[model samples]
Target chain A: MKSVPNRILLLLSLLGFASALTIVFYPLFKKPIHTSVASSMRLKIPRIGIDAAVESVGTSPDGAMDVPQNLDDVAWFNLGPRPGAVGSAVIDGHSGWSHGIPAVFDNLYTIQKGDTILVQDQNGITTTFVVRDVKTYDPKANASAVFTSSDGKTHLNLITCTGPWSAIQKTHVSRLVVFSDMEK
Target chain B: MVIVTMVMTMLASFASPLIASAATTPSLGSAATYGILSSTYTNTTAGTTINGDVGFTTGPALLPGGTHNNYGSGSPYATAGSDQANALSNINNQACTFTFAPGAIDLATDTTHGTIGVYTPGVYCTSGPGAASIGTAGIILSGIGTYIFKIDGALTSVANSAVTLQGASACDVFWAPTQATTLGADSTFVGTNIDASGITLESNVGWKGQALAFGGTVTTVVDDTITVPSCTSQTPIPGGSGTAGTISGGCLWTGPNPCSSYGPQPQKIQIAPVAIAAVPVPVATLPNTGLPPDTKNNTSSVIIISSLSALLLITYIVRGRKIS
Candidate 1:
């Protein structure tokens, strides 16, 4: 009779050991993902103190994407997929004024790694993104990374004029683009 | 057909080394034209001499007492006049495309020259509120490589803010400042300076490259010397076969008569190892125990729970043996 009880205790201890092991290992396994595609309507970045409405824009007659006339407003490439969609979406703003004044993205260069970027769509759904990389491109260079479609994952690229001002061209010398990946 | 294919493959194998060697130097397009170019006006004090052309296309103004040699229609600059415009455009286009080194030291907040080290060819930038200042100890750029310093903010040089070069040239160094760029008195500098707003060369600054202000304005104090690197010696062959210098030791400053102290002189500096990114812990290779990687926080809890269960099992077994 004692042996029976002892055996039951041993079985219970084994079950307890297995449960403890499972609890410890659960996080190592890949977690299930909950993701969806939605049209981005508003963008917010608390770290950068940016909360702005997004406007849809298309390519201009010169084959370049049209820019927002208002410096504060950000223009999104309308021809591409929405921000939370299965591909890359682009948004751009002015970093400085033609007269050497500060523009909307004057402080955008202050962003750091691991900061969160929130994008809300017309449907009221929000997608969160984590910054992965920040890069600057010459105004006249070809930047396929900011525009090209990527089916592998969803990304959001924010761009603005940066670098030295060109008196001859009356424009910034380079463009600064911040790349973020959608958080799972 | 088989023999021809084999021969072609052999030729390609032999050419691989040549191609690899040629890839090190990046091309600077039309940007190489001016030793010093300004859009509005160029102002200089007496005794300021420029070896290359001094141009202000927009304002067509240059301050008196500064001599500009080796530019304009009669000068020997390779890309002068109309060709220079294209070269500037080319440099503006290509310069931004290159990959800047990661974790570039923030030299802006450090108004006082604090950084001292040897840097390799790559884009160094300052994104902070304060302008980037080349600290007092100065910086040594090593290797015959291209170096681009892009300051989105303003740029200030303290006195004796020296820029020493190893195997580099004035033509290969580029300084792009978004706002005002001021060189302190008696500061030594290298590279073509493309300042957007304006540039003020403090008294007696020794500049070894072009000082260009896109807005067409450059202000130089008394006794500032600007030497433009010569085109014949500055231009690198397409195949990277020959350099611009034919001097016995190395290519000295480019000009009809090379300046004695103007070229890159050898310097000793401690080169820091390139920063390596942290590798993520592998999940797939973990033993099928299905637990998260044994990080310190996770391991602590796991060990406690495991220890408790093991103790209970041992107690049960010991008690059972005693009873038996």
Candidate 2:
């Protein structure tokens, strides 16, 4: 009788283990196809009071994304996928507070977690996204993270220069990137 | 004692470099100044049209001056050879030692499969044979930044599998293949430096970037066009990010080169601005900063704690059996 009860207990434990493994690896088992989407035109963030026009900026002849000449506009990398697309859409702006001039992303560093960002496309379709990550890299940091797209989810990464402003380099000492994910 | 050993093992795991997935991209240094640079061998066939200057250092006899009349003779040849030597030294010393950013995608993840479609700027590396290849539709590289394809094994492109760029300058792409690299027939490619052991370009391939065989040799056929990017107006600061440093050379467009008549720049679109709501000051205090949580370290910690719990449970089971 005791052996029978022990056998039943062992069977129950094996079933529990199998169920736990299935729960943990469900995402890997269920492969989902993620399709790439189109370009975005407008960006809205209610939490930080950020509503601005986006300019389609191409790569500078020097290989970096061309910065928006106007401080009021944000430069969107036109070559990459649009915001809410299958890949990561990168947008950059000046965080200039130098020479007494305030730039578009001046308060970008103050963004909080869970903040909502809304992106609108040319076709009048809007996608809602939430702040998922924020990171800072030194001026010499490998910026490849700003461009990688393996997760298959739409990501909008906003970039602005932070840290000490170097007059010699004519840019900041570091770059601040805020990562947001599309609301599923 | 077992508990202590297990704890120490877990601690050492956290301290191991292999546990970290991030690696930084290496800087190219002075090597970025050249179009085609070879250390040991540089030669071209009769029909080969080289738009850029070619150079070689350690040669069995002499590096072959290209069929191009203007660039192959006299002063151009000497200058190109010397430049190639300097660039090769810089590459072997600087670029080879440069740290790589954490490579996210394993180009040979499937080993048998090849990657296609548009990709953003980043470092893609592979460690095995049949690592990375371009398909018939070809692969497009988007963005205007530094992109590195570090292949520890061989790199080959299928026929008609073009490697195109979107808004990026060809000079920004760097292909560092540890083994031989072959461009298939009729494949169009853009990029600056290719630090490889041996590079072979098949017939009828239009290449906008330079091929630098830093280790072995470069073979190019007459029907193939390898135009070194005359980055006259565009400054190519390879490796690092942000502002580019100033570089000096004869960069003015006095005449047309291979890619000069490409086209006008793409137009920029202006979108109307939307109204933004006023930002509110936070009233509550939070311990954690506004950045993403440190999930990597936290996951390790969770694993360690779970293992300890499991060990304790096993110990309890043993004690119970002994009592019974």
Candidate 3:
């Protein structure tokens, strides 16, 4: 009889442990989203822990989109609704050149759908985003606004290279983007 | 009856003591006959004059615009010359020197300088490296004991060329093509550098975007004294007054925002200018560029959801006995 009660208690404890584990890892998989502050945080590109190459390239109005040589090459700025609003948040780096990671967006294309991304802001806070879609675009193409959602939805659109490598310009004609959404 | 009629007639003829007395000295914008400096003037508050240079205690005001205005000093400036401004056009086609018409404009009196017409038809700034034919050399204001370089024009940067702000005073500006509506009366594009320093959207001045977007960039000079506020979700309006200004959509100031939400970093605004001070450099001592305003919607909703989740978690744990 005692064994039976103890067994019941053990099962309950295990169930509780599983629940706790689910809640703990929920942010990495499925987590509750709070639009208020989550959407309010600035969606920053450039992961907090990842070390990116800083390149130096000439300046252009189109900005260092496909090609960048240094931190100066990549025009760093914000585009999300607020700083850390959910949805797909994006920060673009140069892909043409670099010293460490060389390509501004070399790893961007490597990011598979459902991958997790964290954006750290000026307050040392991190807003997480998960990859959802990856789209490719051409430089001359006027489709950069794809990252912007019409319904006040915030998203990060990352731009980079894809397809067979080219020798003439050294890269492909079209650009690939890894689209992510706020992990909810 | 005749006396009464005369009095009424005189009143009508005299009008209400009108201030219009001085006829315009010159046509507002482009000069006739191929001129050296061509520009445009766009003013949201019609009749706000782009005074020629304010009287400087020292030498000539840099670009013949205005003078000695500091940040938040309420110094009025001219608008981006609407049509298209070719300050030193043909720098590529022709051999002409172009300088960013001075900005430290302080409209002590209603004045006008540079050009007086529409400028740069299409976008943010007149797109060009002047065709790269303009060469790398650019205008530079070397010395100063307080001077002004007023520009009611867009200082567009070429491929190799850049517009440099070297004055020691606040270069008050009134308009940018994207932020101010007067530039694009019937347009459907977003203007670049809307966040350019000294830019403010007054009385719904520059509100239109490609599709109702807010968030333009402005560059501000920093100093050791600038404070870096903690990042928060709080959106503080630009000016102290509520009605006068707004937190329009989203804004990213050079300094850190204390009301930031989520994960924000310690954006040290003063660091930019302060870091340069250590270099013992001249212009290097100043912060080079600035940030643009960020945007979107749904941010508030997302925040709400985050709050509720936290509350639920707190309540569940607090109300229930300890579940080891």
Candidate 4:
């Protein structure tokens, strides 16, 4: 009778040991997989009280970078590197919304250097970037540097139309660009 | 005794396969220094600026206009040429995670896109002898992973077509075309072109990568700008370290080669499966922490089970001794 109880205990302990080992090594045997669903990403600027969805935007028919259809959301330049990638990852939002409704980057100009921006990817990994510089450019500025980075460091540049509204151009006369680097 | 033996066997089996694996990036070696490395370099335009080293075995050594280190047919040039060949070979050997159908393959159309095709990092290839072209609509390469486009035939881009990078670096993007590569006029291109044949840059082309031709000439027309991409760190090649043998020279761009020692290596981003068709929805609820809840639970459960097992084993041993 005593041996029977001991046998059950031994069996239970052996089962527990086997399961613990299985759990410890399971991830190693499993293949790591990822799917690129750009919509799964989110952008948050705590300083500006901005937490908005990020939509992948491509080039328009006129060969210019496209923007999000909804003013509340921002458009990620899908044609360039991702937000946390090695090159400059660009995200553009609208400063002015119709009916004076709140927009994603309405207060983008208020963002000062050293501000923190968080980008959450599909896997829920949040990449933090620190604001480095803030610059304003003419509507017709070359703006090539806004999309490309040569220093090989990861960068995130936020763009929103700023300055006085341009009635002739049907857009803002100046553009605001917030340059940020990936926090080490 | 039998149960203990069985548990020990299970533990050994599980622990024996606990080998760790890491992803690795392809080393460019000395060739990483050049914006244009070719057998023969020809320039028809007067105001072309190459932002990196320019090397050729045979050609006019003088560039029409640019502050660049020109390497003539010498040791450095020869080393770069050999390095280019090795890089091309390493690229060719990579297994294609995604393969386009045979025929004239248009990358802009074959890959999924919202307005333009946005490609994640992976080995994208064309089967058989099919030419690949980026249409006038252009294509976007988004993500940090290594992108290797292996074209079995010629590669061409339409005029004004732009290869945009979202968060992808030009340094991590590689293009290996078996035949000649021609960039349309005024088009913006990115990534290193290791073409088996020659590479031709039309007028007013802006290239943010290298043009490395194996044996053919690399020609640039009027007002072409070629800049070598500088990568401080790169996403490792998926699966394992690439077959590309390690070469010595580090990042060579003009400014401090921040990538000289290949800075902090980021986690390898795996290629997404190609079957996803629907447009990515804006924002889904994401986990609040870096680790998902399920993973945390699993980890906790493992720890608990391990503790319990150890305790039970000790108790069993003690009880057995007491009974005896």
Top lDDT model: 4
Instruction: Give the per-residue Cα lDDT of candidate 1 at B148.
Output: 66
Model 1 chain A poorest ten-residue lDDT run = A31-40
The per-residue C-alpha lDDT of model 1 at residue A146 equals 74
lDDT (10s digit) by residue, model 3, range A14-118? 555555555444445533221111111233344423333222112234433223323222322222222244222334554433211233344556667776766
In candidate 4, stretches whose alpha carbon ends up further than 4 angstroms from where it belongs are A1-184, B1-24, B111-116, B232-324
TM for candidate 4 is: 0.43
Better of 1 and 3 by DockQ: 1
Question: TM-score rank, highest first?
Answer: 4, 1, 2, 3
Q: Model 3 — interface RMS deviation?
A: 18.0
Ranking by lDDT: 4, 1, 2, 3
Angstrom error at residue B208, model 1: 0.5
iRMS value of model 1?
23.5
| Model 1, span A1-184: residue lDDT tens | 3444677767777877887777666645634221111213578889888876665555565556666544455666644545875556777765643222244566788887788989875446789999999987766566666775434577988887666656566666677778999999
What digit string (tens of lDDT, one per residue) describes model 4 on residues B249-306?
3232232122322224333333432321211212211100011113223667778998
Model 4 chain B: ten consecutive residues of lowest lDDT: B284-293
Q: Residue A64: error of model 1 in Å?
A: 42
Candidate order, DockQ descending = 4, 1, 3, 2
lDDT per residue as tens, model 4, A1-184? 2454777778888999899888767655654222112245689999779988776555555555666656667777654566876667788876654322446677788899999999986457899999999998775566667876666588998887776655455665677888999999
